[model samples]
Target: MTWHGRPSRGPSASVRLDLREPARRARPAVPHLPHLTASAIATWRARMLNEHGSARVFEGLARQFEGAGFEAHLVEEVRGFADEERRHGVLCGAVVEALGGEALTEAPVGEAYPEHADDATPLESALRNMLSICCLSETVAVALIGAERIEMPAGELRDLLTQIYADEVGHSRFGWRMLDALSQRLDDEIKERLGDYLEVAFAHLEEHELAHLPEGSLPPPEGVVYGLCSGPDARGLFFDTVEQVIVPGLERHGIPARRAWMRRHGGAGLS
Candidate 1:
């Protein structure tokens, strides 16, 4: 469901997929079939596509940061993040293949919101992109991945997920660092603008994670076994991450956490 709010300015430019093929290095063969059902395989492939798609978003952010004359160090950090995301896509593809799915080739198409808005200033766009992708999405991903890793039996899947989790922690930290640096420049107008965008970003993230399911439906059992949370668990984690981690962090950096927006959106609703 969509949040009730003013329409965000649509993406000014489309994201270009990074069509570079993953390295052709041989992967270790799985000794036995994974306990995944057809639906589980499909979920894994979808996640693979999502990971692959993220490379494009990160690349776009890197380009935007450079074009906006952000600091050289931060620009380089973003570029490195792009490379890391591409690697994550490749790793995820390997997991899919191990689980009897076809290799991922095409990156998914989507905009990183803040960078997509034509009306926003470069810094505003950058801040929005950072908040949506890094602060919210990647941060939640780290928690999800860690939970999955904990539940997964010792196997190739768990190992690969662990690697991704490590990288995600760094990526989330990068978002925070950028936000902290950028916060120094945020006047009241920018801060208010951030508050307005926070609800939109939160809704966007919720859609990304749960849009395929019918309203009030839970994730399948295979999904839980394969490291995905049930609908209730996912919803709980999202809100908890916002309230306990993201919101507090933002407030510490002098940005409003927009608690009213969360309340308005039924952020407290059970899945």
Candidate 2:
């Protein structure tokens, strides 16, 4: 998935900048300086970039909500998530700094969100994106982050993880709740359309996640202290979240999530 509804970056799109969060509170102590490595520091820096990018994604989602004619209050709530994601980015950047890495990253060029389909209705388009963004992606995020948080000991890193995890839970719930609200109006046809899109959505989700989460041996014990995790471990958790949590949750709403998942292949069912 594409991040929908982001504004164009125009002329200065590729500028490199420190994506750090402005300090709104005291900086948390950075533990495990002795455990730091180039790779680990890079990981934290990458997280900083990812979190900042999420802001743009959420901003697009907010616009989709508006286009779908969701309630004004709920649309505004979705809009607010952009700021929260920016805060998470800043927090991750701080950790990178504390680890002696710069939070500088190239601003993504052509910052535009895509319309999932040319023929889909505004509501169908919104449903497709929301399910992909929040239900699948954010739900997986909640599980992965929560797992890392549990492995962490008391410290700034753990605290940061906790904050992010809570927000992710909210993000995931927003999609589910939105679905519930729209359920009465979904009708059989709309529900079938959504089920059809699930195959494509699940395929994209798997491809994107697997690319980022490597298949490898676990990280050393100290890596966990710095919020690092084994690629294999994270991959396992991601699949588990999709199968056990996301699929079942969607099925409850009369979606054929299991069938879609089983039949999923890259780009299937997309127009």
Candidate 3:
């Protein structure tokens, strides 16, 4: 009844940042906007601060995965993610630095994992962590990406988003696929528990901090969901994948593929 791909185990060796396609480069700064455009500056800086904090949380959670006896590959992915975020922070800060500033060193994520993780049995702790990553954060991530596209029309901003949307689909898929894998081992009792967990997690994403970025932006509102969520082509691809592939895949493992979940969560399986 937990989220998937935040795998507990993976290799411990250092990971190289070699992507078949390189990670997006540090973008050339726009010459106009005279001085630091305060709105864009604050919006981006605030977001990067959150990213650094989320990365820290992921780093800690990765260790917890190791302690729980998951494979080394999970640790390796975690390390890789941590490194990528560090680089993201660096690249993002370059823009700030261009304006004569530096990103704050690193900020801690404001929340704490629940007591169930510390005091409960293995199954319970695992469920807690999974719920935290997959249901809560991953869902929020997708929404934010969609929202950012609508609000920030800057080329650099759009480019950054393209990279995130591509990578994050995989992360979400991992968590969801993991959950489907788990459903195979359980009875209906567990299914109900999982359904409840997903329910609450989705509800959390509905709250204020996550609903969208604070309203103002540079290019004016392009409608609520960037081109991705709000457009036909992207929506078609998202729905086609969910209906044709992800939902079918989950159904194979005895997980219910509620059409509502797909629309709300997107084809959230391993994209």
Candidate 4:
């Protein structure tokens, strides 16, 4: 799945996404109990907004790749990834609706741009964005989804989580594949520069507060069984994913883990 250079034709020509059947099969056999409280509905709405934002970011990345003269296959793959994200948004919206929450009709505020990208070269910015959104964010997403899945009882909610998890795994791998391919052309200095951006990207992610749960609180039975975790559990998942999955994956791809940055930020950083 590595792309050394541009391909003669794009994947859009041959690749198509059949989202309907899987989505249909993944639907819950029995109706979900409408036990969601106002707070819970709000939370689900927020998640729907996040998924919408993710779809937009992926769409932006696809355009960025095309404009930067990346391989046609890679560009098309990213485009397909954008479609997947959009589908994820729809799925999340369905959950929100089922929980008695309205779909977020408006687009989420702000946009996805890498920290320090303003002054970076176009290729550098693209790489940084790739690492942030695909590598870091999607990897965290997989872990979070897994945590939620564990607490979720067997039902439509768990089924939905499974579907989303599978897509996220592929999305994370897409980032690694691109990084591996790009490594062949990028010099050590440039790769190191890209690696440095990981710290900034991670900091930005924390600042955005994408999924922070409260400290020392027990997991809410209602939310946990419905694909949500407690504050403490969410925070634990974020850090664990970074240390266990993200750092090692980056290191394997020749990207530094920026352990110093992590240590300066908190305890037992990434050893």
Candidate 5:
């Protein structure tokens, strides 16, 4: 199945999420139902769908890890990541209902995962996806959610954001640690291929973030209480995370990540 990129299916493609849980578990308390505007309800509903999509992505990554002969522990961790994303979906779905929105969304299509390059080896292919999903995407999630958590009032919404933030940190760390674990196998050829793929990955990252996080708009204080944030803040945090965190992390592993990022857009970074 495709690991990322859900093509738009319009409203006809919408499906209601199953929110029933047989096993009882304590869920985060959501205390702001009255504060949730229609816009916030829509945003949380979209987040529920996004979490579900992320679960599918991690499921594919788990299979990729296992097929590539990665350590059992690492494969297990990826599987756990999938489960966590599913949990996040459920959590977000509950919040959607609490905020007076239906937990319905367009389902993503299933297909073979895309290759980073035609001639890329299996290990290279897996690493490229990992770098995209975990290193860049999840890392940016940590930054964005962390900022949101701090700005949010000490309430159930903040508590929920904290939980998600912690999971994202683990996901981000897994990418870098897995890279370290496979360091010996990253021969010069593989490093070069990964470097080349970084350009493509960075480009995709920019497109994805720009589409998800708009620019020049900040949620009002009331909106922040409902877990909203500034689009411009998110955009700036994304580039800062890329430059300060991801580039340096990749460079430490002998990948020409900075160079690849510079090449991501005609040697001029995003405005």
Candidate 6:
């Protein structure tokens, strides 16, 4: 799937997918529906605008990663992520604008860490920092795209969302592998820090955040793959990664993920 470079200004660009059944078998992260309406749609759109920043965010992260001593390979990986993130900004911005609204171009919904910043950053490199970015971030994105099946208006918008979703899986897998490789050599202190970082990241994801995100179905015109327009359990699906996936993986490494890290300098470091 590819971004058609079209503005998602209507029902056409907004699509949702129902990957709950498949997700349950895979990780048990499913969206439970109640009801949906235009208000719900606006709520989700506003949430995205409030939570996520403009395309500048992706560009910012890319520059920061490159400035850091990250491997060329890792930097390249961030490029891919940046591409997707930039496109998401465009698609989301278009959706909100088309709906006769404005997107937040100044402050972002979530706070961003600077490139040269210390452990005060969410992108702290120690431990599972990369994993949180890749595995956890991408995993939730994939599930979110799936949950869209119920909420998406069913058309071109659905296609764009899915395209973004599919790409996230690979990104998540790559981050997972990177962490897995580092896991063997990492110490218990680093693992503890990773756990703490992941916990913090999870706090940023609330159900209401992505609840109204649109979804779509393929080979449409016949019928939608999921519900016409239903609401999913945004809260449950959002944090599935840390609770169900990443946390367990950390535990297997004997890492204490739930507890807060006591030290200020403990995390992926620059030195």
lDDT of each: 0.64, 0.76, 0.47, 0.64, 0.74, 0.46
Candidate achieving higher TM-score, 2 or 5: 2
**Per-residue alpha-carbon lDDT of model 5 for 63-90, expressed as tens digits?**
8877778889889999999898887777
RMSD in order of candidates: 6.1, 4.7, 10.2, 9.3, 3.7, 11.6
Give the alpha carbon lDDT tens digit for every residue of 211-252 in model 6: 333333122222222223222344455546456775576566
Q: RMSD of model 5, in Å?
A: 3.7
Error of 4 at 173 (Å): 1.0
RMSD (CA, angstroms), candidate 4: 9.3
Q: Report the Cα lDDT for residue 157, model 6.
A: 49
- Across 86-114, the per-residue lDDT of candidate 1 in tens digits comes to 67666655655665656544432464434
Which model scores highest in TM-score?
Answer: 2
**What stretches of model 6 exceed 4 Å from their correct place?**
1-68, 94-128, 150-154, 206-232, 239-241, 258-271
The runs of at least 3 residues in candidate 4 whose Cα sits more than 4 Å from the true structure, single-residue gaps closed, are 1-35, 112-118, 216-219, 263-271
Q: For candidate 5, what is the TM-score?
A: 0.87
- Top model by lDDT, which number? 2
Question: In model 1, where do residues sit more than 4 Å from their true spots?
Answer: 1-35, 105-117, 212-225, 263-271
- Model 5 local distance difference test score: 0.74
Q: Write the per-residue lDDT of candidate 4 for residues 170-214, one digit (tens) a residue.
A: 988898888887777887888777766666777776654432454
- Candidate 5: clashing residue pairs, number: 0
Q: What is the TM-score of each candidate against the true structure?
A: 0.78, 0.88, 0.60, 0.78, 0.87, 0.58
- Between prediction 2 and prediction 4, which has the larger lDDT? 2
Candidate 4 collision pairs: 213-231, 214-231
Per residue, candidate 2 scores C-alpha lDDT tens digits across 12-118 of 65756476445324246777556555666677666766777788888888898898888899888988888888888787777767776666777665357766759
TM-score of structure candidate 2: 0.88
